[model samples]
Target: MPERTSYDAVIVGGGHNGLVAAAYLARAGRSVLVLERLDHTGGAAVSTRAFAGVDARLSRYSYLVSLLPPKIVRDLGLRFAVRKRTVSSYTPAVRAGRPTGLLVGGGEARTRESFAELTGSEREFAAWQGFYGTTRRLAERVFPTLTEPLPTRAALRAAVDDDATWHALFERPLGELVEETFTDDLVRGVVLTDALIGTFAAAHDPSLRQNRCFLYHVIGGGTGDWDVPLGGMGALTDALAEAARGAGAEIVTDCAVTGLATDGRAAEVTCARGTIGARRVLVNASPRELAHLLGEDPPPPAEGAQLKVNMLLTRLPRLRDSRVDPREAFAGTFHVAEGYGQLERSYQQAASGELPAAPPSEIYCHSLTDPSILGADLVRRGYQTLTLFGLHAPARLFTADNDATRERLLAATLAELDTHLAEPLADCLARDADGRPCIEAKSPLDLDAELGLPGGNIFHRELAFPYADPEDGQGGGAPARWGVATGHPNVLLCGAGAVRGGGVSGIPGHNAAMAVLEEG
Candidate 1:
């Protein structure tokens, strides 16, 4: 017979969310046990030495930080730090022998000059400021409410205090909104990319899932800025795990939870090693995974649409536009083949089961922002790390022939990158001890197989509005009262699948803890 341990609460999964929940519960003087399937914790928010014979630690999956709430960071007393990127985004648009690019957030004069070069007018730049100003206002109001009980649609709209902002973001299609606001196709694509990241949907998809994704991306801590972790993403999770352990939480790795059952008074979690019982069980897995563990019919699997590529470059690639600095261009998100028409064409192709001719992707140089990711030797050698997220490559595209499709998509993506660079990106790649280029590509299928993300969806399932939408009846029954409610009373969701639980944020974990503590 397996040994049984009793705790006040049990958290299944040791992802960032699980760790967050464990910390909060244990800190509250409740005995907690966190079970993880993997040999190591952190889930996707982890760092590893991907290249052989290289001492560089790369944030293999889920690289940047933005959505993590400040309150949780402070409340948990986490010691990790995040560094802001100087350049927001740089897009190269070389036209007829004229080398020019759109640079946002670098300098006021430079940004206006870039906009003027691209659109032949300064009005578009004014429009850009106006649009982002509105988002900033919306973020300020909505972001603070994430950690609290879910608000009704009317309450949230009233808080925003701008009818146009509410209608444009909540009711209208994001694509239509972007088109109406921005004049340049590239500018529109940049704004719309937020809606499509990790989500497989067109800008105008009536489902409005894109809008939710967009809102989350832009509302990070009310500033909508994504920052680089000081010591890779692992550092952040390590701090979280430490906080949990310090609070007397027991975290067990390589302990895959096989089954979960609740009997009103206590919840039983059966794992490979043993069974644990607790008054409350917080599920930190995807909704689909939770259903499977509970022996219930799983919901439709969420499909992840982005292809992630990690590459180590011996040196930054030279850009065709000689005016812009390569270091600055690659520092932030380097948009590649992400024009409005380009994105639409790619989406249509992927939807039809065909690979996009030019996969819309963006690349960020992590080492440029945070050199701590590299070893002294690697840094001295002028090596840098590049993480590319390819949008519109959904799970279905890889179902038939994952390897073949991955290779095709990668080649297409690289070819697209080569268009803007003076040299092929592959040529700047660092070599491993085995002479293999220090590069790897992961498809949606790979994410599912490796990280246990169902259908490789990073956000777990399709993202729903964080607040309860009663008019649409979207939020799973009684969402406005508590978004983390699992309807089982004893079980609660504390993962990305929960309401307001997408991104690297620990809102779900914090909310779940609140639910448990409130009941007591």
Candidate 2:
């Protein structure tokens, strides 16, 4: 064994959440260590040199940013290191069979302009305002407090009693809810897109609580607009690494964590590098991956398998006959949803175990927004860059069943773009696979089965842990019996899998830190 190094806590993955947890623990004067499987940190939240000189991010995988909490950004002093920009979705009206306009944050003036264009005059805008307001309140009041201590038993009961006041609202499908609110197809599509992103739910799934997860971005404050972190998503991770080092947390890259060594009191983590002992080990890898490392059931609880594919494009996709202005080109997210029918079919195809033939893609053009991408020489080389993110089809579709599938997916995206964009996507520089992520090809599905997780679920346990069963101690925002502290007395869980749902938010780590401080 190498000279054993002891620490207060050892975070397993160096993703944004892991880094956040490390920083919080170190700030409290505790020795912390972070281990990353890849050569660099940030897990899925990263930027790499996919092409020479052109630093691009796997935007197609885990793209978009509004879900992160503002408190973490301000508290971590990541204001300068990681920043946000305004981005919205633009879809051509007639080209894709119908018009799809889902714009997120241009300004007060632009908001008015967009509202006037919608079918309804006063009633439609008023309803949108109501939905946005309600969604914002839910995110701000409910989500930020997710990691905090649960309410008392009586409080929990009372909250549920009150919740019954809007039983129909909670029970109805998000699509139904949106339809009841707006009359215009464009406006309806815009609002409903919120519920559909990252979700495999059918457009008419009655159980979908898009307001629960989707609203987190619409009104969680700090300019509800989505933007790319400067340089690449990598800059955000690099800043986290910098913060971890600054706060006295030791970080080792190119080291993969294989298993947990639990002594019933503390955990001794087994890694490719060796054993790392810590009072508590926070896992930042997806819940699925953590489960794999633990060697238990796959993908914990209710979350389904996460299949991601990313591609680097040579030419920027030029939307034909798009309503979005050229100046606001890179300021919004782009989607290929033509209407509700198309959206429903996409989900059905994925659910049926087959990939979508005409996959819906989420596009982000880094070269269009970031000035650093326009550096000399590379600009001369016509090195325009963008990311095309879409659904993962059947794994069987790949060449090696894995290798060729990635290429096929990328090729399909270019073919789709070629049909609409100004110039066909050309330069094929790099590709990343989220199913088999990092250098070792450690997949989320493999992680879930190894860990005790239910379905290779990555959101940890399930998204509805607190809201689902009343018998569970977490009912109505009440903490689990485990609370922030782990089953082991000396250990604590400070990763996204811990609480408040998932995202780049540091709530799990921040909450765990408070518990440790209180325990001391």
Candidate 3:
């Protein structure tokens, strides 16, 4: 028997974006086939029983949900859902030789008190409210346009309506805005963390890369709130796969795409199983992967900066600050050594080819919000999961020896975390069936090799502002209305590389499907 040799659309890579495209195109009555290299459909968005014999299922690579739009959910009839955290974030600090922390949820009054206590003034708290108020407006105006076409820089500026905000976010370095807006170093760092999640940049970088990262984080669903998926990250991908299949799209796993060819009207994709032809090809891989498949030279390389660690804890560790409960603090992002000055120093160290003496990181406990990820037995036993994202640890750091650097960096990171804990983090470790600590760490290099993320960049490349650049159409055809256009008319980028793409949002996938439909 032979597999089908053709489809109306052949999508390479089976990540959530690819799944979205398949569902839309299939629903539109186009024959769609999705090819995934891995045995599973989910790319980095997966849930796994990480430790041997562990009953807890952890969102291994990419966790949390903030960018996915409700429109996509309704349009696809997805069964996925997310729960908002009661606490936004908790940053532990030692003030006036007293162990204290700034907690940013519960209520406006409580957060204000924490801010006042930290700086001995309410100035920063007022600034926090004002800065966020401005961003909130910007988010509302800009987020709605993502699923539509890409707007020119001038149009987007006019759409934003506020010249000050447009310039602050689009034109100037994010660091300058943060420093000018917030007086407290810790508060400034808290605001800045949103800009540096998977990005490697200083606040003052002239390129404004941090600003681009900051926009996506703050504009999620127009609220900037990062919610926890009811299941693990895999659940979202699973729902996407279901929607796609139900819409009559064929999904084939373990089928690696080797090459792609197009003649401006039709395309052929070579995969491990066989070659398939299509009228249009939608790429769910990165720009580099797309170029390689098309036999074209890739652009300048991009490197991701972050260290990821997942742990199954016997119990949540106690915080140095006794006022806030561990559950409340861990439920939201737990900031460690991420003071404004500390973050800058760490970035400088990493840029100069050395590991940050004290790495900036954040921890989150998904179980507190949704216990379904853990087995009933583990839940009854008070076991929980903690995911750590360490900043300033780029792919370059582990190029020489990924294995050794991971161990050293993991140890140092945990040790730094221990300094702010009542007991060492190791004390809360849950042992697996084989007597091994139920824990794992991944550096940028590890993620690259495992997930095929070029240079370990999660967003595929440095994120560009959602709007079209001034040079967008200089190559002479109409500007990419959907931001998914490629050199060949029959091919389109449906991944994070697309304009207004990045995060778990399905904007690119939706836009790609729209492009194909409009062309047809």
**Largest lDDT belongs to which candidate?**
3
Q: Each model's C-alpha lDDT? A: 0.89, 0.56, 0.90
The most accurate candidate by TM-score is 3
Tens digits of lDDT, candidate 1, 435-511: 99999999999999998889999989888887775553233433335687664777888999888877888888898
Query: What lDDT score is found at residue 244 in candidate 1?
Result: 99
Query: Candidate 2 — number of clashing residue pairs?
Result: 25
Off by over 4 Å in 3: 470-479
List CA RMSD, all candidates. Answer: 1.9, 5.5, 1.3
Q: Which window of 10 residues has the lowest lDDT sum in candidate 2?
A: 435-444
> How do the predictions measure up, each by TM-score?
0.97, 0.79, 0.98
Please, what are the lDDT tens digits per residue for candidate 2 over residues 1-520? Answer: 5654777888887777778878877878999888887787776566555433344443323455654666767777773343455545555444246433445556756665666654436666677787766655444444444455755435533444535323423455667767777786656766666654444466566555454445444534433556565666666767777887898888998888889867645778888767778877776655555556667655424543333444444334455546665335534556554345665676677677565666666565666666463446555555555555453333333314454555555555556655555454453343233322111121234334443233434445534422334443332211243244443455455555564545555666666666655655
Write model 3 residue lDDT over 19-99, tens digit each, in one string. 999999999999999999999998888899999988888999999988898999999999999999999999999988889
Steric collisions counted per model: 0, 25, 0
Alpha carbon deviation, residue 297, candidate 1 (Å): 0.4
- Scanning candidate 1 in windows of ten residues, the lowest lDDT window is 471-480
lDDT of model 2, residue 3: 56
